[model samples]
Target: MSTHFEERSGVILCRTSWGSWYQTMEEVFIEVNVPHGTSGKEVRCNLGSKHIELHVKGQEIFKGKLFGTTVSDEGTWTLEDKCLIRIVLMKTNREAGNCWASLLEGQYCADAWVQDQMQRKLTLERFHRENPGFDFSGAEISGNFAGGGPDFSNLQK
Candidate 1:
């Protein structure tokens, strides 16, 4: 249902799901855990071309315009580790019927990267493993895109 990213004294949790209707977007929620007694009182993020909204202590912090897929933004902040923590909600378009369908569907290659406090950078190379008969239509229709479905006995190998 979700994936967890953890490290010493901190954790980054991420959960994603498909959304309703013609939109059929993938929604992602993230929570970052900081260490105790640290408080600069700010938060920063870099969400590339996905809608995002922030909240702290059960209160709305920032509300930004909803840009379908063209605009992207980033921010940084300092805060207490024991604080309520920060959450980022993001949504991206589905691959079906879209221009990038084949590529987004894992038929191609993707590149990714990450950085740590030591300024060390990690690069990743990825490719999609083919699932011949997998039906993505259900995810395109219903908001529940978590991935359990009927067997693909009908799909040709």
Candidate 2:
């Protein structure tokens, strides 16, 4: 519901999350500052079933899938002035029926991005509504960010 950021190890971390009837999903994005005078120029990571794409300064730099799942993806980058990482995950009705089509029909899709930081911990999450014209209650992100930071620790059932 909100967006928050924190500074750790010369990297800026962002977190966001959202809730639904079947599950609660969260996403994390990281931006690392490359060392001075470096020429490599780009870095990226992707995982899960959601084929994530990463871009630097509006240019596609990294592309890949999240593990064996096609429901999440992430990307990272370091530029001359700053570095950024983004992660996205979706709640999919991969089931074999039309259950999703019966819940969210004709409703405006609501999507949100949030970041929160308290004490020594950071949280980033994104919420997306998968309104497929029909009444489909379920939703998913279809895109995400790459590596860095903790292993999506706050995501729970």
Please estimate how well model 2 matches the true structure, expressed as its whole-model Cα lDDT.
0.29
Per-residue lDDT of candidate 2, residues 11-100 (tens digit): 222312211211123222323333344344454434444454544444554454332232443323234444323233443422211111
For every model shown, the clashing-pair count is 9, 46
Candidate 2 Cα errors over 4 Å, as ranges = 1-25, 40-157
Angstrom error of the Cα, residue 24, model 1: value is 10
Question: Per-residue lDDT for 157 in model 1?
Answer: 56
* Candidate 1 TM-score over all chains jointly: 0.26
Highest lDDT model number: 2
Q: What is the C-alpha lDDT profile of model 1 across 6-107, one tens digit per residue? A: 111122111222111111122223334544543444444334553344444444444454434422433223343465344333334422221121112232
Worst 10 residues of 2 by lDDT: 95-104
